[model samples]
Target: MFQDISCLEEIPIPDSLQPTIFIQNSLIKLVKNECVDKFCRIILESEQYKTKIIVEKLAEELVILSQIRQNRFHLISRICQNLFSESYYKEQLRPLLLRRIFRESSYYLLLCLYNDQIYSQNDIMNLILEQKRSDFAMYFAPEFGLIDTSIMIPKQWVKKVIKHLSDYQANDWALFKEYRTLGWLPNSIVAAIKKDDLDALLDFEVDSRFNINNFIEASPLEPFRLPRVNTYMSLAAIFGSINCFKLFYQSDIPVTDRIMHSAIAGGNYEIVRICARSVCDGFEAAIEYRQNEIMDWLLQNSLCKISSAVCMDWNNLLAALYLSDKTETNEILIKGMNEIYEGKAIAMPEIVSSSSNYF
Candidate 1:
């Protein structure tokens, strides 16, 4: 009967008694096909052998099978998890086998691997916290079923990753809809925009723009917490970059980039005009900070041809209005007044005091 066993289409293990030579030999081929579900069941139930085989050997094989079939390996992973834990009962498996299993998994898989066990759990957690969105998710999702099966991870971890992913792409070129769709985006990103580290936010926002609808419509980055309103504006203004006009107009998100911060701080400039209608609620803060760039963007436009100032003579007007130690404010002021007289902005205001005189 044993001689003809290999000839069967799908091998069957018969265990009325313990440890059949036939099943033991076939273990190699059977595990490759996710047949371990049945094999494991047999091992636990049988009275066949006084000594059971080591679990690591089984786990090693399952890991190999998982890599080979890949797409359908969840079954193998489940089996591996079961076997790894079960093998500990014997304390007989190779030490390398356990470490190898953890290393092979992606972020989500590794996380699950670490969730319970105290030995390697902390190391795995540190890796998870350090990983970025695209790399982290793709690396681990396949092995751990991180993105596929929603049932495994708790709500808290899922939310944390989502938030971090959004912040990662905050400066990316993808549209809001596209960014929002990625598995990694989180609500904490928005909260960060509200009150995050001003210096960091300003530095990061330097080249980025807000193209979404009024800031309110734009989604938030999650997980990161906010600071006070004053701190939010001060640093963002000093370092914010030049972005689309609509961003200033539509910026209701409460955080202003450095350019706008400067414009608002300086007073009466096109930058201010751009932000005057913005959805962001902190223009008053811009005034408090004495954003010269913002003030110049607003006032300089009024000084040039109304239609041509921020639109046509942007460079020339901005150059004339944005002053440094050598740029002689009175000279630019005179030049601006003449331009205003010629174009006659609806109503250009007199030069405000130096932004530095106040906040």
Candidate 2:
């Protein structure tokens, strides 16, 4: 009998009967499409197909495809957990799944550690160390009491891990104390500023070694130097951590036009207001970064002056006209320029076409 089995969804499975070849091939397609509900129903409800070697091969394909896509990891975990309840599936699939997960991603490895019954704590720790995932190893080792002193943390990750530990309130933990004793910690003041951990900053201030002037007077390259207002405080503005910026501001650190440029790039209106001083470079940065709010703010606040030699350059005007996405922003820029050059009778740039209405 010639049968049309092209539409797998329409195929009806009879009770207690083996799924035909068409249904089996359709199951593979379902796995690829991540149709979890239908895949599980068909596999679990069917008597013959679930026990076949093809099911094991399908599960392996699912893991490989999910890893490559960098998503649907939860579905993979759910599939394994559901299938693992059966002794035959568990015994057949465990080693293959674990090996694939270990080779794919540290994130997936960590997920398997928490979600699967396959890995012991020691196994996870070893995998973390092998992967050089210091962030994971630092917390996991301390939490599970699996600290391996011989494992070397990369220098770049050490400070970030320290900040994470403090954020998690793990400073009092023995591992933190051990890090301090071993001189693995960066400058506490800088760490506190970067973390916005005001409490830790206060505690450090009470120490005899804590000297605010030492940080302030230190050269920019010095290890003890305070965070730069232009760099670090600008980041604080981006993150909306006004308290951290205030901390730096109250310390009487010198502010400069570079700070305004950085704040403008960050696109925080309040920081731009607080740090506003020079608009020459700030306006250029705003134009380059396409920060419309900052551009509007600069024009509205009378901060931009095209009469300034810096802004009068043809390149600056051309860039502003070409890069501005909105006609309103371009008009604002031209209006600001016109206000500055009022009564000079100097003609506007030829690049300002009538179509843009920037006259």
Candidate 3:
């Protein structure tokens, strides 16, 4: 009898023949066979089977079977994915599946449903905070347009979201503005700096809480090392924001060699000129980025010498030089390599020959 019942799934029954009794019996057999596809097709095709009682019963059976079957999560999640297309099924199944899945700690399933737009913003936020899943909450909330509810999120999470937005180079002004209003002043400033939003940075400056000089002087490494206000002077250089660089430089933010390297890599001659007087050397950065103009300027201005003993990563620089066919730049690099060999007692030919292997 069960074999005959299971065979019924292969043939599409007429709509009039799809009574509730047939569907209920077939569903039990299908669940036994793990025929998730046919089970969903029967539910979706039959309007009568979409009722609350039927879906609730299916959910119960799946929950029970999931405990017994090792791959029950995958099977049930696949069923949910199929059922999500119908509005009525989506509404009915979401809560039932979420309740069962959440209880089982099947977070990947929860995330799949969340991505499918199963959870409302409030539902996810409450779920995340209650479970203390701040990592998931910080990234997921902003992406789902839940920035307005950021106040309810912890300060640390807010900082993390700000850093996330900044790192990904997302330009959500509404989100940034909200964070700024919440007294996460320093983090917002660093985000603005990293994003090269001078106007937004200036707007942040007007607030009495914003002590521009003091803010520049202080460097907090809480969120991550990259988004700190002091260390991010290189951001302006790399982004080719001369005005922003001027703003940071005038504030007496110390110009490190990294900043000069970033300026060289960015190929902005003006910012490079500004950083040239301050930083010790940018020879490797110029060669690596193939910034011929900056390379020439550095050498002509005597800002960086080929004879400098601090030629860190000579193989990388040599590879860059070998790849660059520019006669003038190659001459400078070859001379620099010779100078390194003469001064530092390092062999040049073997390193030069091996440099091509980097490609």
Best-fitting candidate, measured by TM-score?
Answer: 3
The lDDT values for all models are 0.36, 0.48, 0.54
* lDDT accuracy of residue 26 in candidate 1: 34
Backbone clash count for every predicted candidate, in the order shown = 49, 0, 0
Q: What lDDT is reached at residue 225 by model 2?
A: 13
> What are the TM-scores, per candidate, against the unseen true structure?
0.26, 0.33, 0.34
lDDT per residue (tens digit) for residues 83-117 in model 3: 88788877887777656654554434455455655
Using TM-score as the measure, name the better of candidate 1 and candidate 3: 3
Candidate 1 lDDT over residue span 111-185, tens digit each: 333444422534443444543333333334323334432323434444654556454334442433233232123
Query: Candidate 1 — worst ten consecutive residues by lDDT sum?
Result: 217-226
* Model 3 regions lying over 4 Å from their true place: 1-187, 208-232, 251-258, 287-292, 306-359
Tell me which residue pairs clash in candidate 3. Answer: none
Candidate 2 lDDT tens digits, 235-314 = 44433355676665677755556556656655556666677643344676555343444555566556763322223232
